[model samples]
Target: MRTLTGREAVREALTEEMKRDEKVFLLGEDIGVYGGAFGVTAGMIDEFGEKRVRDTPISEAAIAGAAVGASLVGMRPVAEMMFMDFITIASDQIMNQGAKIHYMFGGQLNAPFVLRMPAGAAEAGAQHTQSLEALLYHIPGLKVVMPSTPYDLKGLLKTAIRDDNPVMFIEHKKGYGEKGEVPEEEYTIPFGKADIKREGKDVTIIATSHMVYKALNAAEELEKKGVDAEVLDPRTLVPLDMESIVKSVSKTGKVVIVHEAHRRGGIGGDIAARISDSDAFYYLEKPIKRVTGPNTPVPFSPVLESEFIPNEEKIIEAVLKITD
Candidate 1:
């Protein structure tokens, strides 16, 4: 097995899939000559040519509208929104049109297209940095997938492209540079499946996207303090792996849901509600703790941004609160 950066892993997935399926095409601003804003699609235009590796104008809505139309006509268009915030411009096409087509047609039609976006806060500031998974999760027909590791990145992406619905594949800006080992052979990780990054019994920590790495670090620190924390990563947000969460909480009796999204309307609230409604709720020794961003816009200053995102220390404190 060879280790690869998150960017490399995603690039490999798209490259390999495009080689295998002619319908798979890349379309977004700066994707052709510019090789994409993050260079994830670098050199792809040379291999696939300009038609497949398209470079559209800076219109997010047009990009999504084109993807929806392409998918409807039997093309698997992998549309890219340069930034996650830009996705809002295309919500009508995504939420109302692309999402409802399959159901409205009563399974007579399928939107087998993948929409990729660079998401999450790193240094890009408020407008560019947002964990918009909750918005896609709210939609009934959209499939939301976020990967924290290179392994999950390749696996879930393949699944999303092959599935029979519209998929929102979110990539964290910070995770793109991080490296991890990934298998060489082709494989797929099913949607709605959760991966337990670390198994323990004292407490369960549920996290998504970049927050999963923070929760893992917090788990290591908690272990040194004589607390065992189980870290569960729900790779898919819409079809969340609630069973894995319930099983972990059933054994640990204490749980903390951590996310980079705001505390008020974040996915952490939904995860907490799922657990509170589950039969495993009786096993809880304490209330489920939620560690997330404050109800404020992400700041541009490095210091303010640091405070805006949840970190290992904040997760550790939340775990301690639930345990003690």
Candidate 2:
């Protein structure tokens, strides 16, 4: 087992997959010599050359369109948007063309490409910071993935590249430098599977991306006060592992959904709704709670930004509400 940062694991996955498949290539602004905005693709250009690792102009629509076209013609392309906010520019291509191609073309065509973007706030201000995992998955045909750890991202990214349809690979900005154990051997995590980061019987906490770590911290603190909290990470949301979530809630009889996205219309709401609509709703001893960011733009000021995002303290409070 080798320990690597989330960013390093992404590079490793890309390098391995590129070597494994000749059709796999990368294209985006500053990805070649500049090594991507956060250096996720550093040193890849020298290995794969410009033909496979293309450095595009500052045009997301063009990057996405090129990927869609290439995938349709039997090439696996990974298109990177400098920031998650810029993904809106390529929405039409991803939604109208890439997402609908297989259905529209009578199942004769498929778009097997990945749109990778760095999301979440790190004092980058309103325009630059956003959590768009929920927004992209709103489209009918997109497969959304938000991996919280280096190991999960490496496996998920590799799997996303091999899939026969469109995938939105979301990397949280704050988690890039975080370190975790990853196997030296190549492996891929299946979609729709839930990982129980920590197990308990008092309450179940469902968290996504960066919030998973925060929830784990909260769970540890709760344990000291005679509360046993179970932390469940729904690795991918679209093909959500409702069976695991329902089982966890069924045992704990209390549950909380957590995410960095805004509370309104956010993925947290969708998760909570699913549990409530399921037979597990009768198993809950208290109403399911959601600890989420406020419905507002990411603040530029450090103080306001910290307040805008969910924290360990907030998660603890939410858990206490249900358990106490």
Candidate 3:
């Protein structure tokens, strides 16, 4: 095994996939020469040449539309929107075209492609910081994948590239610099599965991306007070590892869902509802808790932004209340 940053792991996934498949190419603004906004694709252009690592103009819609067309004709394209906010500019191509083509055509053609975006907040301001996973999760035809660690990032990205469908591979802005162990050999983590980052029996803490780390920290703090919290990362929101979540809740007899996204209409609500609808509902010792951001838009000021997103304090309070 090798330890690497999230950015390095993603780069490795793209590089290996490009080497294994000639049809796999990357297209985005500043991806070729500039190495992407986060430098994740820094040296790819030099190694693969301009054709495989293209640098497009500042047109999000055009980039998505072209990728959708390319995927239809047997190309596996990975289109990157520098920031997740810019993705709204290409919603038509993504939601209507890339997401619906295969199913609408009765599986005659597959949109075997991926749309990558840097999402979540790390003091980048309102427009640059958003956990918009809820939007993609609402769409039936798209696969929404979010990785919380380096190992998951590499394996999941590889799976997304090879799958015969459109995937929204969300890279949390704050997770890229974080490092973790990843296997040197090739691997793939299947979608629709949950990873139990930490196991506990008191309460199940379901989290995503950076929130996973926060939950784990809160769990550690709770341990000192004799409260154990299990941390689960659903990984892929669309296929949503609901079974694992339900099973965990059945054992723990309690659950708390957490995310950095705005609380209203967030994925936590869907997860909570799924549990409430399941046979595991009777196992609860207390009501399922939810810790999330405020409903207001992300703020540009550091002070206001910090207050906007949920933190470990909030997670701790919610968990403590569930236990009490």
Q: What is the TM-score of each candidate against the true structure?
A: 0.98, 0.99, 0.98
State the displacement of the C-alpha of residue 77, model 1, in Å, after optimal TM-score superposition. Answer: 0.7
Cα lDDT tens digits, model 1, 1-324, are: 799999998998999889989999989999997889998999999999999999999988899999999998889999999998998999998999899999999998888889999998978888999988888988999999998998999888888888878999999988889899998998889999999999999999999999999999999999999999999999999789889989999999998998898888888898899899998899999988989999999999999999999999999999998786
Tens digits of per-residue lDDT, candidate 2, 182-217, equal 999979999889899999999999999999999999
Reference-based lDDT, each prediction: 0.91, 0.92, 0.92
Q: How many pairs collide in each candidate, listed in order?
A: 0, 0, 0
Q: How are the candidates ranked when ordered by lDDT, highest leading?
A: 3, 2, 1
RMSD of each: 0.9, 0.8, 0.9
Q: What are the runs in model 3 whose C-alpha is more than 4 Å off?
A: none
